[model samples]
Target chain A: MVFTTTKFELLTNKVAASFGLPDARIVTVDHPLGGTDRATIERWADAAVDTVVALLTSG
Target chain B: MADKGELLEIVDASPEAVMDYFDDRGWGDGLPLVPPTVERVEAMLAACGGADPDEVLSVLPPRFGECTRRMVAINAVLAGCRPDVMPVLVTAARALGHPELNLRGVNATTHPVAPLLIVHGDIATSAGYNSGLGAFGPGNRANATTGRAVRFLLLHVAGARPGPGDASTQGQPAKYSYCVAENTAASPWESYPRSVGVDAPSAITLHCGENPHNFHDMEADHPGPILEKAASVMATLGVNNAPIGQGEYFVGLGPEHAATIASHNWTRRDVQSYLYERARLPAGLYRKQFGSLAWFPWMHEVPDDHLMPATGHPDHFKIFVVGGAGKHSCVVPSWGMTKSVTLAVAP
Candidate 1:
């Protein structure tokens, strides 16, 4: 998490090798996270949730 | 008046306090998360038939980590997904694992195009994925959330955060969620999966589409001339022939345009062949002074050369007829200077 842009291959392999999954199974989207991995992932989830909640709540 | 048998200890905690716990722990995508309340998480699990959330889908590489169903649920909840939509998310994730898809490359490249999801069969209509007018735009929950869920999974579960793992150059808006459905009812051709070779009840198909450029031609209805115009745009200076080696292009033929081809009694293959031939650049245009030099190395070697083949192969072009009725059709230029990897949709 909290990654730089344009590292699709490096990141893909990292995620795959980290979890022992093959590289083919993952697709990276362009969402920026601003800290360490654990904190970053949490923030990303929260941001996404906020967008969803805003949409749902407004509707 | 509440009876507390083995009641859990209750403490008032601000929402931010809870978010901090997850956020500071680096357990999220730098955004705060709604705490995975037991009820919410349980509901999510039930949607997937109550499977173990910890079951590993894969151990993502480059960083070496495990992605489990439970973790995915956590992100889905955060992504604002309902439990009922979890099946579609799972299927899409599984499809990303397809070898032909080159997910690793897609995830790491600086290309603006991300995986574009196309749902086919009964599931599309049942799930409320739009294949009609404004299908590419937002509004449908199934289309929006399903696509959002994938992005969430990649960010949280797989950890491809921008400036970290993701490296898209002029990142596209489609990165948020590029899911849509094929307008099978409107399309004159068979389902895309069938064309690509797959049995169908309904499933998802994934492709990579850069910024979509339109080809609006109201002047013509005949398939031959229309496709020639369209193909020329696809192979034109800036937009045409970006494939590095052998690559595929996504051509979404609108119903009105497709109907024109049908009127001329041209099968999809006939149109493909016609476009394939017409899409080629003149040999003289392949010089270093011209921008076609980006793909063909021979251009530099020959200097003022214009005779080298623009595309590595004629079959590099792939067609998928879709969109609502209109004289307009479009080609989603490949972001990579190469062909996109195609993967099958899974159950």
Candidate 2:
């Protein structure tokens, strides 16, 4: 699964398409991952985990 | 006779129409280009010292185009370069291909850094590179076109076109063409190439860098105070150096500034060491600026209470005296994780 920020959504999508990966295999976090506290990072990680799990588990 | 690449019949009524054809095809840097006629390309190829035109110089990314001498000559001709400047362009290309320079990340990343082409030694003067007043600006053909040729190679050959391959959010003016020669005659120390232990009479150093941030100090006559002012600018929290903490930083000192420091009996090594010791951000301040998530594993190696140096070491501060005459100096920060590479210009 791929993870990126909102600002990078266009770039991420383009890169994903280049590698022949559809939108289902990609995930995106917030605009910036810097300057955030550990709890905020954990929250982003938590938000991404379900999508990551589902992508990995799917046939 | 046409070269190996596919020949295109551009049936234009006038020269302007032919230029428009190339522009319409998105092959230009938005500047007027010298028509790369077959003869002009062959003239450029002649300057290559018998190296096979079809010989692969390097494979540039993200498209991983195999750049050959002929391809480079074609771009050089289009960038309006004199045939003599072909060797310098070739050497600069080789430097870009160096593995440690990390051309892959530099070409593809969202960073606003452009490869700064720094020429040193006799070839700098021979090629008419502007190392004096307005060195980084327009007015010199060699400085301008040699750099533009590299950009063209990156765009047409390497496929580092913006939006798709090159993800620069807001690229600087330097992206169009960024090339400068060291004012070796005015400098207190030897040329950068010789100082770095390379015996070549000419060399090119490629650093993935941002636009110059001018550091002014009209008051300081002594080197110590001048360096203190420079250290302040170097330690700015927002720059890539402070946050990333793992690349070289360049300080281009004007002639007057270099003379002032030289009078104090300070060598280039002294200047580098002084800046390294002072240009640091405290660990607490680092965390405040970038937060804990931004910390690299290397940051943990430093004591939590200590101030982390802007670069890996004192040597990472690449200090070179340039510019004709001024009290002003400039600080150039680098793209993180990419090291500057220098290669001797082939005859």
Candidate 3:
């Protein structure tokens, strides 16, 4: 399983496949995390917490 | 090409058709390429001696493509490399796979880092490689094509494209081709390979770094002012070398610059030591900006007022003379996670 952003989605998939995890569980957030304010990042993280938990909990 | 690995032969193997075909499939390096002909590939392979064509050198990351000797020949041909440079190309392939070089990080990082190939010893002149004026610039066929061949290898074998595979935000031009030779003829000291204790007839060094940052000192009769200018370039926080522990700095001195430095009876070690002492900012400034750093043990133990070296060790400041008669030099800063590897040119 992996947590990544939208920009790295394709690269994550490519990396996953190379490491023999073609179907690795990958959760995507927004495109960028750098140069953003803490409040915005925290809000995004808060909104995505439930989905992340569900994905982790799912088989 | 059927998949990423298999380069299938197209029926229309003409020059224009081949270009369009590869361009359409995201295989071209955004430049005109010499079509990989069977005869040309055969010639390139023949220069590699009795090595197995199908032998898998190493599995490159990001795409994990199995790089074979035959594929090396194919890419070399496509890069317009002369058959005489086959052995060097083969060595370059093997060096890229070295664990210490960290090919995986270099391919995936967003630093605009490119694998800089430094050719040394007899190979520079033997194969018509450039080690003189405009060494880092264009016009020399051997230097240009050989460097282009390595980029082609990364593209075809390692599967490193700009966006998907190579995650560089704004990749620099060095990503296209960055190869130069040590100006042994004009250098004051021994050849770079010999100075580094490599006794080989010819060797190649692969360093993943940003483009050269030019520094010039035309009026300096001594080495102090010259090296001080270079130190100023290395001390800035913008470069990766400023914060990282093992980030290497390759200070490329021109002929006249090296002569000026050598006239004061300074050895390579002396130059390194001088740069290590001079290329520093106060430790307190670094601590104020960077929350955490990949610093060497000594950096952490130092006082707040202590001048912290950009790269912790003196040895990390790699000094070698390149370029022709000029008072200019350049600093090639490493990506910090990768290490340079030097290997002999053999099949």
The candidate maximizing DockQ is 3
Evaluate residue B345 in candidate 2 and report its C-alpha lDDT on the 0 to 100 scale.
88
Between candidates 1 and 2, name the one with more favorable lDDT: 2
Instruction: Report the CAPRI category for model 1.
Output: acceptable
Which digits, one per residue and each the tens of the lDDT, describe model 2 over residues B150-177? 9998887777778666888788898899
Give me candidate 3's interface root-mean-square deviation: 1.0
* Chain A TM-score vs. truth, each candidate: 0.29, 0.78, 0.86
B238-340 per-residue lDDT for model 3 (tens digits): 8876678899998999999999999999999999999999999999989888877899888899998999889878988888888987778999999999888
- After superposition, the stretches of candidate 1 with alpha carbons farther than 4 Å from their true spots are A1-59, B1-36, B49-54, B59-64, B237-243, B283-310, B337-347
| DockQ in order | 0.25, 0.32, 0.74
| Pairs that clash in candidate 2 | none
Q: Estimate each model's TM-score.
A: 0.71, 0.89, 0.96
Number of the top TM-score candidate: 3
The full ranking of all candidates by TM-score, starting with the best, is: 3, 2, 1
Off by over 4 Å in 2: A4-59, B1-4, B13-15, B292-305
Worst 10 residues of 1 chain A by lDDT: A1-10
Per-residue alpha-carbon lDDT of candidate 1 for residues B1-347, written as tens digits (9 for 90 to 100): 11111222225357687667656656554445556666776687777775666666654433323556666666677666777666666666666555666655666666676778777778777767788877777788777777777777676655666755676766778788777788889888888777767766776776766756778778675787778767776776564344343456678888888887888788878876776667765555644334334554543454333444435545555666667756777777665443443334332
Residue B21 lDDT, candidate 1, scale 0-100: 66
Name the lDDT of candidate 2.
Answer: 0.82
